[model samples]
Target chain A: MVPAPLPQQLADLSDLVGRMCTHAAGSLQSATAALLECRERLALQVIAREPELDALRVETEELARDALLFHQPVAGDLRSVVSTLRSAGDIDRMNRLALHVAEAVQRRHPAPTLPPEVRDDFAEMGRVAVALAVKAADVVRSRNVVRAIELDHDDDAMDVLHRRMFEVLMDPHWPHGVATAVDVTLLARYYERFADHAVAVARETVYAVTGEEPDAIPI
Target chain B: MVPAPLPQQLADLSDLVGRMCTHAAGSLQSATAALLECRERLALQVIAREPELDALRVETEELARDALLFHQPVAGDLRSVVSTLRSAGDIDRMNRLALHVAEAVQRRHPAPTLPPEVRDDFAEMGRVAVALAVKAADVVRSRNVVRAIELDHDDDAMDVLHRRMFEVLMDPHWPHGVATAVDVTLLARYYERFADHAVAVARETVYAVTGEEPDAIPI
Candidate 1:
């Protein structure tokens, strides 16, 4: 059977990327629930699903390579394929970061990785990260440069939350020992990086559609 | 003027990636010095040089795109260009992770980020990361599948160092407290990620040369 047209292939690439982003978001949500509630089963589920996202990334990249090989697409089409290739990597990284969160939950086992004082902060971080991933999926599907650029602002919220986590760790009256502090520090970094990858996906989408850097574009 | 032949252009791409890896290693070396010595000037210098690596990444990618556009390379040539494109990104991230180490130094300014107890551990980590980056640069330049495959084992050293940092942090008698523990955790992550990117560059090199995933290759 003749392969779909280049445009159809490109659209399929976008859909694949969107699915990866959504999957990453779901994994992160589950991982966060595991962290906050001390649920090893949920964390284990998130960990088990990691290879699924890795497979999706490999499939997306193979599709992109084939698109480049067969279509020899130029200009916008070339940009779309290249952008999808890069975005798949970013989305896969988001999944890996979520896996790290899940692994943290497993490492702590019956004990919660997050202290009671900072549970709300981590819950908020997890919420914001999932939102960014979901919005990043929308941006990939829509290629709406406006919404894509808005992801940068959305990531600012994540940065603020990351800083708050640090503040809690640094408080002089803090009771959690160095071990919990290390856990919180690494967990915060994972969520921050997850949001960063989501923003990276949006940036790739913006670049794919406009051939302009997302930062240079007027929001 | 006539453009270089496709083979020549591919060689140029390899050279460009090699330079990026070398530059990244230098930045990490300086950043590590800054972190261990509390040398704000060195940290600032590393910070100032970030745009240089960023520009190099853009130039490498543009060259890769032009090769694809004009030459329309097939098979191995196509893989070479694609692998270089991905490796450029990994090397750029190596530079960014180095910059994070520098920024941590600047944040802690007058006070050294590493406490005396873990100072040697971080210094060792810094050394291992720089060695990995330097070896990765060699791998990019040589495309020696054997040497490229060696980088994974090299990264195992980095992994050991990373775990050691956590051990120091988790020690019961640790006196650095949460604030310093937070700094150490992030700084350790930066070094670990820098080494990971170096290994990723090697994996790309292995794939480019052998058309086989690095892990799948018999080492």
Candidate 2:
């Protein structure tokens, strides 16, 4: 049970965590934006921002942990704060991964051979990655379990999409050659992990409320 | 604060969520088993087990959520339960993703031109996936924050391996066209995500201990 005397502390902690989630989510968005727009400057900025977000993650996690240890909260309170702390880490890593992709892309501009048929295929991967990060942030701040759950179903599509991405790269007729193939490899990874991490944030949210481990769930 | 009357409930809920996580981690291991031994039956089993695990996730999440609504926990309690529930989805998805690769690998024998290489990569990826999954389980059950924090660094290696796997695929001299390419895509996604979800799990663990986000931490 929430201690009647602790409202101010709870609100402060929640707000700080909420901001952490928002910033982490913003980093994800910036990473994808850097990718989609091919803005080297933006990509650099995203990469630069990585350390700050990482710092925030560590900071928030420490605070939550300290609070948990010192206060030894009730079942519900303990679960929520602990998960938030955990999700912050998830959010941070996901953001860093996104930044990694942006930098990888920036370091080597490997434009995939767009056989008119594969027009938006690569772009779609970037879009999805950004979308996943955005959803993860929402899950953290709002703790919307249903929204969090959506990440699971949508992730299958990521598998499917990346498979298609490879197919396009492997096509012998593709004129761009190895560059297209290499680009597919890196970009596909970014999207794959993006979806995976988003689902991670959601899993934590569900855990926050349910105290259930993710392994027990139906796949 | 820790509720005076909820210790039993806390233990019960933690045990339940921990069970789910344990199974989810096992599923990842089992799913990888399909590739390590190249046994189609093993792969099938992993897929078959997914639905059961999925069901567990849903049930536990609902339970945790109900608890949250019914009883407000203090910081530590909230973090514990919430991290468990949150991690459940990531672990589940990781299991499913590994199984996705297993299920596909189960479908066909690799072409001879490079079956050995593909097999090697698959086995390695599976090993990596299982390693991460196992560690995640350890983190949750043992409440090991350092191990959780270490997961972030591990993902970087996963990404490196993914790129190396790609190099093998694009060498052109490697032969066994089209199919090997597909294998690379699938295996790459699986390994990459395995690392990612592991990082997510670790992040949550750190959060459970410390209130910092990734960007905020010095690590």
Candidate 3:
């Protein structure tokens, strides 16, 4: 049996994933803005739009299966297909978390801002998420190894900010039993985890480019 | 180009995944027993054994890549690898969580057993985790379709037990504060998520046997 070339199949799958990632990137940025800017309508949109991400997941997986079965392409082609299939789900999950943050923002009834320290972290996390998504989208098309690695820095920045945010909320100095503290904890977690998935995408890119899992992100 | 027989590569990769899964099952069961029985000594063993699981993951992925590149396997092989990759991570994460439980147990002064209400849930979860691991192992060796599909039930049972445990713990009457509540929440999450990974393995089995993802897992 002759095997079909895999580059075309993988390219098609990558293209689709890239577009959906764009949607995901857009959704998260919008969701974060809605939260910080007090746009209830936008937050509602983010909450309602989660299904789109799920849909992309199902569709991407199906397409990848079809490609894998049809081509049975060896080597880099197979790696790309498998990686895209798996990474799509991870991206969708992160998108949903961003929407969840937007929902929480809605419930807070638009006080117009997060507490000063917390808001700074949220803003930083949101920035990192958007940049990470853009870099992820970029790498699939170019497979630029160094560019792929850059996304990890964005994730690192988010982690630094998230840790600072968590520290303040969890501090013993903070009055015990504040409801806001709990909210802050969950919020920081959402953003921090969003960064984590972004880091995962960066890892996948390294796998795609180098044919090896790079060492754990630099300290 | 003459390709290797598709079935041969598929069988080989699937078989490798199944064996590692079986080993993981036994180790995880022991890991849980180590925790619940206050066997910190065993816990250390569990912690020490993680490298094996990681090795299994790397091996499974390499095999999956081989199947894809060499034979251009059809739907079933592709799905198996996809599912195996996902499940392998799940298994590793569960191992990590079990290690976490062990560490907590070691640090704990042993004031009391886990609450009676949740103790049953924990025990049942542990039992089912072991059972699922065993069944998944069997699926690997024999490629039994029935056992593969039934993997869903093991996962469902874990989820129900976990949710019930949380509901009980969260009741104001349970007398837990922020710290205690966080502990229970994290523990419950660990088990719930472990079952989820097991269910994922079953889903792969179904995909392998039937070449289709399960439409629904019976409650």
- Fnat, 2 decimals, each candidate: 0.62, 0.07, 0.38
> Interface RMSDs of all predictions?
0.8, 5.4, 3.4
Candidate 3 lDDT over A31-110, as tens digits, reads 88887788889988888888887777777787788777776655676678777866786687678778878878788775
TM-score of chain A of 3: 0.88
Predicted candidate 2 versus true structure: per-residue lDDT over A1-219, tens digit per residue: 443333344444555655665665576667666565566777777777766765666566556645554565666576666566556656665776677767765776554123345447656766676677667666666767788788888778778897887677667765554534555566566667767767776787787767666444553
In candidate 3, list every pair of residues with a backbone clash: A72-B72, A74-B69
Complex DockQ per candidate: 0.78, 0.15, 0.34
Q: List the residue pairs that clash in candidate 1.
A: none
Off by over 4 Å in 1: A214-219, B214-219
Ordered by DockQ, highest first, the candidates read 1, 3, 2
Q: DockQ: which candidate is best?
A: 1
Among these predicted structures, which one has the highest TM-score?
1
Indicate the fraction of true inter-chain contacts that candidate 3 also forms.
Answer: 0.38
- Report lDDT per candidate: 0.89, 0.64, 0.68
* TM-score for chain A as predicted in candidate 1: 0.97
For model 1, residues B139-188, the per-residue Cα lDDT tens digits are 89988878888888988988998998888889999998899899889989
Model 3 misplacement above 4 A: A1-7, A30-44, A99-123, A161-170, A173-188, A214-219, B1-8, B23-31, B34-39, B75-78, B99-121, B139-149, B173-176, B215-219
